[model samples]
Target chain A: MKWQIISSDQALYFHSWDNECVVYNSLSGDTHLLNLTASQILLKLQQSPTEAITLAKLVPPTDQSESHAEHELQIEHLLAELNALNLIEKCQSTINYNPPSCR
Target chain B: MNISTLTLSELGHRLKKAGMFLQTGTFITHLKTSIPSVAEGIRLLYADYPLVEHLDFADFHVSLTYPRNLRRWLKPQIQFLFDGKPPFKPLPADQAFPMLEWGLNWCVSSHANHYLIIHAAVIEKGGYAAVLPAPPGSGKSTLCAALVNRGWRLLSDELALIHIGDGRIVPLPRPISLKNQSIDIIQSYEPDAVISRKISDTMKGTVAHMKPPANSIIRANETAHAGWVIFPKYQSSVPAQLKKLSRSRAFIRIADNAFNYSLLGIKGFETLTGLVDASQCYDFTYSSLENAIETFSALEPPASSK
Candidate 1:
């Protein structure tokens, strides 16, 4: 599935400092404090709707434990979290399947 | 003219009769009261504030009086009247003066939407203001008093009125309210500081007010640009440390602290973003005023911002 920012690109304002980002949603009049990973995902989604595997590429490795499989899983969880907050929404339906690493 | 120009008897007489239009910072208050403690509180603290002999309008027309009910004499409670209407329940007669101060603060915070008001203590030096946003018992007031007594100018002890258009801080220097042990600490910290009489057994136990510096009141027209936003927390036995905080975190904290952030909607968000752009954010912790002062004095903004 592909996820996209719920609001227009202009409605989501970004002010980033180092690794943290603060997004002010003009549509709902809410401000959110997000970590670098969440910020990058939102930024990517704002530009264009993208798949979980594509969003996973934005995350750089933090430690030896972070493999490609873990990065994809983390991105999927973040996308769901953002969708839950009404910050983003699912644009397209994909198969109800998981990667072989998780299965 | 100033309230000091009037004798104590004259001040009380004016308050009993037609209210005097007293100017503190940018707002004029038409204050009238039959309660002597409120009169004395104004006389003691607002001596240097400007007064208008005749005025057409006032931002707040407030008065304090004992209710006609049995509570007036049974327990002797005083009610704060905003335009002859009570906004809050009556307090003990002894707490009349504090009620007036609090009511005046409420007047500004509730109605004044021209600026994005934040619940913070503001101080200025070298053409820049440091905004200290903290919750109660965080020692922001104590730190603010110590800073002003040392050298910095007190912009305000409570509300920080950041103009929506220019993002400059409009000075609203009012008396600093000290609670619990802070009252005694300030007295010991500054020997010359004049504080009001302590009133006990109110909502905030054992409260006293330190008179704002006359110079701050006199220079109320001067405004300062945003420079730094520091969130200070008092920790016992902790070394004074100034840690760099992310601008995003500070942005959320300040918006949460703002009085009209939600009311102003999109404008508040834009104004806050501009503020965070210009200020460096920090989290400060200290137990000693002297050490805190040293740490603050050493703070430097970029040359470009100046």
Candidate 2:
């Protein structure tokens, strides 16, 4: 599945310190603190819509030893969390069901 | 002219008929009340504040008066009026003075959008201002009282008005409200402290307000740059300690305590971020007022004899 940021204006109000960012959502008049991973994911989505697997790869892994399966799982979790926050939404684009057997 | 120049009778007369305009830092309040206690509180506590005569505008026009009902005689209570409307329920008439203070706070916090008002106590020394943002029961008022009495200037006890454009703290120095046992603690700590008459059995337990130092009221117009943001907590029997807090955490804490952070929206975030960026942040806990005073005093450079 593909995902994209719900709004482009969010990037204009982004402020970060170390691994955390404080983003002010103008629509709701609410401020949210995002960790580095969540912030990076949003930053990536803000640039352009990307496949879920590709967005997962974009998130910098905290531990290099983590397996690809684990990394993919973590990205899926963050996407769900961001979706719940209304910061991101699933893109309307159709998924490519014909699998490339291996990357 | 300052309120001190007005005789008690004159103060009462002004309050009764024309409404006296009292200036505190940037805001001018037109206060009117027939209640004698409220008049006396103003005479004693706001004596040093200037009487803004012929002011073109007042930030708030407030009044305290008895209800026109049987309750006026039986268990009398006072209603706080802001522009002829009562925003809060009436309290026992004796609590009129505290009610005025609270009403003024509400007026500023609710109306003053140009400033990023934080629910904190601010004090200055040698040109550096320390912003102490803490929750109620944190002993912040006690510490602020001690500091101001010990030569530091009191900017404000309840509100720290940070300028949105320049980030300097605008002073709103007013009486410091001490609650419960802390009232006696401050009185005992500083034998010469001028505290208002204690009104017991109110919502905040027993409450008393300490008159702001005359010097603070005199120099109420002086704004100071943000220097430090200290979060102080009073824990009995613990050794006085000061620990450094990260700027990010301090930013969150300060934002949390701000009166209109959300109301100002993104501007509030930027202003708070700039404040934390420019100041050293700390979490201070102490069991003793003396220790707290000494530690804060040391933040200033050694004073030269005048």
Candidate 3:
């Protein structure tokens, strides 16, 4: 399944200090504090939709980062969490950029 | 003209009839009430606030009066009316004064969208302001009272009104509300501090208000840049300490403390981002007011926050 930031007219804002990032979703009127991995995944998804495996490849590995399989698992966890927060949406493979998973 | 200039008789006469136009900071409120406690509380606490004479407009037209029900006789209650319509369920008659204070706060936070209002106590010194955002019983008001008694200028005790345009703190120096043990603590801490008669058994439990420092009231129009965003917590016998806070974490905490952050939408996010960017954030835990005062006094605004 592909993932993308939930499309909204309102903009998303990010502010970081000491590597901690807080994302404000103007669309949902919600604010979330994200760790580096989660923030990086969301930032990549925000640019455009991509499947879980491709998203892991897009984010560079960190010093204490887990292995590739574990990285994909973390991405899946983050994507599910973000989607539940109304910050991102799940897209199907053959989609014309449309959300079919619990849209 | 200040409220002190009007005798209690004249103040009552106006309040009963045309209502009094009182100005706090830039907002002018047309206040009407025949409730003696409300009148007396205003007389005692708002003596320094300006009485807007010859004004054609007021920001909020509010009144505290009795509900025309049986409770008005048995366990009588007071209702807050804005523009002649009651917005809150009637509170106990004895809570009239605090009801008025809370009502005024509601007025600003509910309708004053021009500002990015936060649920914080802001005090200023040396041209910089510290925004204290803490939940109830966190000693924010107690610390605010102590700081005001010292050299700090009181911007606000309950609301931190941040100017959206320039990100400066617009002063709303009203009476500081102290609850429970805090009342006696402040009285002992500053014997000269003018506090209202303690009213007990309300929503907040034995509450009283401390008059803002005269110097703070006189300097109400002066807006200061936010230099510190400190979340203060009070515990018994704990020594005062300030720990650095990440700006992103500070953003989330302060946003959670805001009254209309979500209502302001993008403006709230942008304005708060600017505020956090220019502020040195900290988590301050203290027990002794003296030590807290000394610690706060020693703080210099972040040199680069500007």
Candidate 4:
């Protein structure tokens, strides 16, 4: 399924240093410290609604020996966590779709 | 005129009647109280602070008064009033001075939104500010008192006020509060330290405030750029050590310690980011104040200073 930020009007302020990022969500008044992969995923999705495959492609691989399937699984897990945090949600178009394609 | 110039009786009269206006760093406070100990505390600890003129506007107008009716005779408790409304529960009449200090802290922490206030001890040396943001019982105030006595200028003992526009720290120098054994620790550490009388069994367990140094009060208006952000942890018998901290971690830690980071929202994030960007962050642990002081004293000046 495609995912997009919950509130585009409420901007997320990001500050990155040494492969880590501190993200502040204005809407929730929450601050989160994210590692490089999580930060990159959020930054990419921030531009527009994106598919899980597209976000996974944007995340620079941390392990060179990891298989494509493992990487995709990791991306799905990260998306779930971020979704729970209310940083992003499933795109409106896919909310009621059967067998979400992104999965 | 400075507060020290006033006679004790005159100060007491002013406090009881028209209120005593005193300037501590950037804010002027109009303090009114009929309580004698509160006047005496101010007379002893804040003697060096300037006396604000009667006509001048004050940032906070506070009062400490005994509660009326049967409780007045039974327990004789005192209430802290800010702008004519009591914000805290009444405490024993003997604890009036500490209540004033805590009430003022509440006033600033709750109302001051233009600056990002961190629950930290800030001191300046070589024109660069070092922010020590630590939790309670970390010996932060003890370390702060020792540093101020040993050539460092105190910016504030509890609150580190950072301007949103420039990321510079505005000095809010005030007394360093020592609780429990730390009060005695500071006394032995600095024999000449001017600390208030210990008020025991209140809430925080044996609280006393060490008078800020004369030079720090004189230079209260001076601001410094943040050069270091240190999170200090005090463990008995452990050797003093400094570990480098990442900027991201420092940002998170500072935001956690901030009094109004979430209240300030995006502005708080930007202000903290700029501070971490300009500072060399560290996690400092010390068992000995001597070792910690030496380590901070030997720190290299920020690159900008060079």
Best by DockQ: 4
lDDT of 3 by residue, A22-94 (tens): 8888877888998887888877877777889998898865645579898888788888998898888766545
Q: Which of the two, 2 or 4, has more DockQ?
A: 4
Model 1 pairs in collision:
none
Taking the tens digit of each residue's C-alpha lDDT, what string does model 2 give over A1-103?
6777774455436777777787777667767778888889888877777777997777877778989889888888989998888788776543554222111
How many Å off is the CA of B220 in candidate 1? Answer: 0.6
Off by over 4 Å in 1: A7-9, A58-65, A92-103
TM-score of the A-chain for all models: 0.80, 0.81, 0.79, 0.84
Candidate 4 chain B lowest-lDDT run of ten? B297-306
- How high is each candidate's TM-score? 0.94, 0.91, 0.93, 0.95
lDDT of each residue in B1-306, candidate 2, tens digit only? 789898899899999998989888899888888999988999999988887787779888999999887888888999999999999999998899999998999999999999999999999987778999999999999999889889999999999999999888899999998999888999999999999989999898999999999999888888887888999999989888889887767888888899999899878988888787678889999999888888886674323211
Ranking of candidates on DockQ, top first: 4, 3, 1, 2
Greater lDDT among 2 and 4 belongs to 4
DockQ (Cα-based) per candidate? 0.64, 0.42, 0.76, 0.87
Q: Is candidate 1 or candidate 3 better by TM-score?
A: 1
Comparing to the true complex, what docking class would candidate 3 get?
medium
Worst 10 residues of 1 chain B by lDDT: B297-306
- Write model 4 residue lDDT over B22-109, tens digit each, in one string: 7777888889999999989999999999877665588998999988868897879999999999998899998999999999889889
**How many Å off is the CA of B129 in candidate 3?**
0.8
